[model samples]
Target: MKQGRSLLASGFVAFLLLSLAHSTLRIEPERSDASPTISDPAALLALQTRYRSLTRQLTQLTPSRPYIVVDTARNHLFIKRRDRIMLDAIASTGSGTILDKPGETAGQWIFDTPRGEFSVQSKLVNPVWVRPDWAFVEEGLAVPISQADRVEPGVLGAYALGFGKGYFIHGTLYPRLLGKNVTHGCIRLNDDDLKSVYQLARVGTPIMIF
Candidate 1:
């Protein structure tokens, strides 16, 4: 009978340890200081159109070009034109946490996407993930994981759109996983839609998430 009690205590202790171990995690890597130089006309045109549409939908005001509307609470993005919504698709948000502010930390902790006004600062194609050291130490994980581990698979590698300081609207490997607040701090989107967004948006495009 005593042995049985001991085993139960051991199991409980193990569970707590496991939970603590998983409290912190690293999804990908950090952004670099390099600026993207796009040279494709077709890609540039698409980005312009998308930006025009999204901007129109969000404000219900017509802009001469296309734009994007990101509503974190609704888990949807609207590509609009004039006063009409051209495209409406599911989007995965920041894990329900507010990390856009400076001096904040990153981890596996789940939270909702933050609501605020922001803008697309830049676009990156085949960009490298520069992992943060704080995430490593907090999670009891190693800082600066290997390049192999940093390279996430799927369309995410194809295009990554930066917004504000550290926030981004990027592609995801799991499109079906949209409509949920499940990203570390970035917004996740479908591959096709992301490609379209990538082509239409440019640096300085306004993004309002609420």
Candidate 2:
């Protein structure tokens, strides 16, 4: 909505292209006055049949329940119920930075946000961030042997929605960094947006990232 375009419209266009790939006729974006029309009634009928089938598939694929859509490229997150968008907020996603592992010769991590479909697996209030090894390494601090040394408080806003494998949609201390790709891998939202998300989402709420 920030861009004044529905992300679902892109999906529909993609679906239409995929559906047309299997058909004999092609739909061109621009045409001259002499553009050929389907003179054969049978071919026109086949095209109509494919249209109906594709429409049905798209309708069936629409989610009935509320879901999250993260547009990592645009740095925006949306909460949508079917065709209606419930919330659209500026967010910070993965930075795509490469950090070398301290001990391993070739080991490194590319901190790009994970894509594809995922669901909210856990939600926490007043979340505590147990800082990982990368955090210490990035800061050039010595890695602590004790786990207690890793417990960090207050930096990760008030709420966190975990989507498994150490990734979360959480609050950020630097709300000014919203709309930028500057996170380790988690999605960072402002406090107000995060609170709304935490209240709206559930344990199994679907999160679609792209």
Candidate 3:
């Protein structure tokens, strides 16, 4: 319901902006001796009223608690509460590389990290990486026939926060690559930063990525 309202407010805001511009474009001299001025005061007043309504809608939609923001373009993660930033850490995001899907069909998987809002669905300690078929394919190895072969340990470091799908904000073994696009799709931070995030964020904490 909130998302629907947000969309509606956004559309309304756009419409008002366009209407305002159109109104401005339509402005002409009421008299040859007069300076240029607003042609329709009533329409402008209505737009201002709608703008106030939209402002309220936007204010109500703002997050009230601590949230996570991962800037994929800049490789930065911020843990923020309201207007204050609690933590700022260098991070690594998806590589945007593609891997050809194995088989006769023409298919491929892009490694770009997903964008938009998500919430922490789960948390983990001493997380284990269950390798996927892509991992094997990327390494030029055949997909393991047994499911047990996919299970790998000690790769995700001591802490992880799952934010839906298979994506996570987790610690990395290669701390040197903290500020680069190197992961498959997950957000990677150093051990210290990961620990701080793990401790501060709880299940259902909102995460915004772009």
Candidate 4:
């Protein structure tokens, strides 16, 4: 009976040891949902340094001389001289309307203000608007082959600054529509604003339109 009891105790101890080992094997490690942390300090510093360099390069690209900026979306103009705003005026830009010719292929004109960097190519006082073919078609008037019929006076107001390819920053007779997008492609301003822009901006003055 003593030997049997001892044998029973030994078997019980063996079973307990096996149970403990099974429980240890079933245990799992804890998990995380957060993103991985950056371990390298040098890569993070290099990214910050590149961002600062780009900002400095943008500041250097600004013009030192007087420049014109046209905001087509807002119908506004800003004349700046070396980071100072010389004039801020309400202006008219393109109407974004399409003029289509009936039964003609590739004969449509989209009246959109061209966006990019341009320069003042010419300046005119008491300017005459030589009406183009589109003007006559728009008005339902007969297209005149002669240049004399196309010449119109007192329509361009007192001053005009031509940029390039027939585009101009000019005065408009329609002063009530100064802040409206009502032009075919030109930039129109009120008399006082136009005079200010014409006098301040000279030939080769940079004009950035966006």
Candidate 5:
């Protein structure tokens, strides 16, 4: 009887050891659901090259006739004709000042030379400056109610090339302020430069300000 009990206990121990070994030594199946990731350096470079080519094709400006290019930050203006530069002169652009109005109907004005493509809509000799509301407000004066009060003569020098929205490339009485950012929102040049530009730049001529 004693021998049989001992043999039974030995068999139980062997069974437990085998069960523990089987539980610990598991072999999970390899994960086949994950997608593979691959990177090609040449493919990335080819995409970048295509994007640059498209951008260059889009931004290339090929003017057939005379065009004006204004460099506002440098206070310079250049008139170009095909491949030749017709006129290059010092200029005065916007002052970039801000005026704040505080009230229910209050608004603000940013005196900046707008950057984009524009065209000469009109030309005037001895152009009168019909001062806007901001002009009066800037000087700390009351805005006039009558139209006659806004008509200030002989301020826009000898010539004016009107782009839209009351902006102009015109002559300045303040010739000393040339090559400086001093205008309210116009391009100011010396009398000689203004005369040349006014005569050369026709209506519908392209003007690019940067």
Candidate 6:
């Protein structure tokens, strides 16, 4: 019985040593001390939260009115509806001469389109061009040969106006030379934009110039 007890003790010792060896072989090696820690849970959450807030704010800030701006310097016209631009186009202005007058000789006249805040008092289709007496006098030219004289060839220049009694928004024959402050004081637009505005806008539309 004493010999059997000795053999059992030896077997238990051998089993314990084999188990320790197996555990050591299965263990993974330690990570290098110089390696960076990989955690960024807080930063990821913060970025997501900020993106959502920005998206909501953008949705809430849309505009609700129509705004029109004409930049004489840029020679561009812009019309916006509710913070979004609907029309962007090129336009021409008076030849920097806000007034027209006769030059030193008859048939010689200098003209300048007037600039100011004017309202669109009326819109005309197939508009007729009329020559006023002042236009003749200013150019030192003879009075128009006849009243109701729609006879001046170059006088009309292509478009006519009735804005503010004598001013106008019209088309120009010199389309190539548009985007210039070079008309007889009328605001000139490209044919397409002119048609669009003529159709869309009505009498008494406000126009402010800078």
Best by lDDT: 2
lDDT of 2 by residue, 137-197 (tens): 9999999999999999997899999997999999999999899999999999998999999
| Steric clash pairs (candidate 4) | none
- Listed in order, each prediction's TM-score against the native is 0.57, 0.77, 0.73, 0.73, 0.70, 0.54
10 residues in a row with least lDDT, candidate 1: 19-28
lDDT of 1 at 1: 45
Deviating ranges (above 4 Å) for candidate 6: 1-67, 98-116, 134-140, 150-162
What tens digits encode model 6's per-residue C-alpha lDDT throughout 113-141?
Answer: 44444455667765666677666665667
In Å, residue 59's CA in model 1 sits off its true spot by: 8.7
Model 6 scores a TM of 0.54
Q: If candidate 2 were superposed on the true structure by all CA atoms, what would the RMSD be?
A: 7.2
Inter-residue clash pairs, candidate 3: none
Per-residue CA lDDT of model 1 for 46-69, tens digit only, reads 656665554444343334345566
What are the clash counts of all predictions, listed in order?
27, 0, 0, 0, 0, 16
Q: Please estimate how well model 4 matches the true structure, expressed as its whole-model Cα lDDT.
A: 0.77
Candidate number with the higher lDDT (1 or 3): 3
> Order of candidates by TM-score, top first?
2, 3, 4, 5, 1, 6
Q: In model 5, what is the error at residue 7, expressed in angstroms?
A: 99
- Runs off by more than 4 Å, candidate 1: 1-62, 97-112, 134-139, 145-155
- Candidate 4 residue lDDT tens string, 143-202: 888999999999988999998889989888788988888999999998899999988988
Model 3 — TM-score against the truth?
A: 0.73
Candidate 3 segments exceeding 4 Å error = 1-60
Q: What is candidate 5's lDDT per residue for 121-168, written digit by digit as tens?
A: 899998998899888888889989999999999888989999888899
Instruction: Arrange candidates, best lDDT first.
Output: 2, 3, 4, 5, 1, 6
Provide the lDDT at 183 for model 4: 93
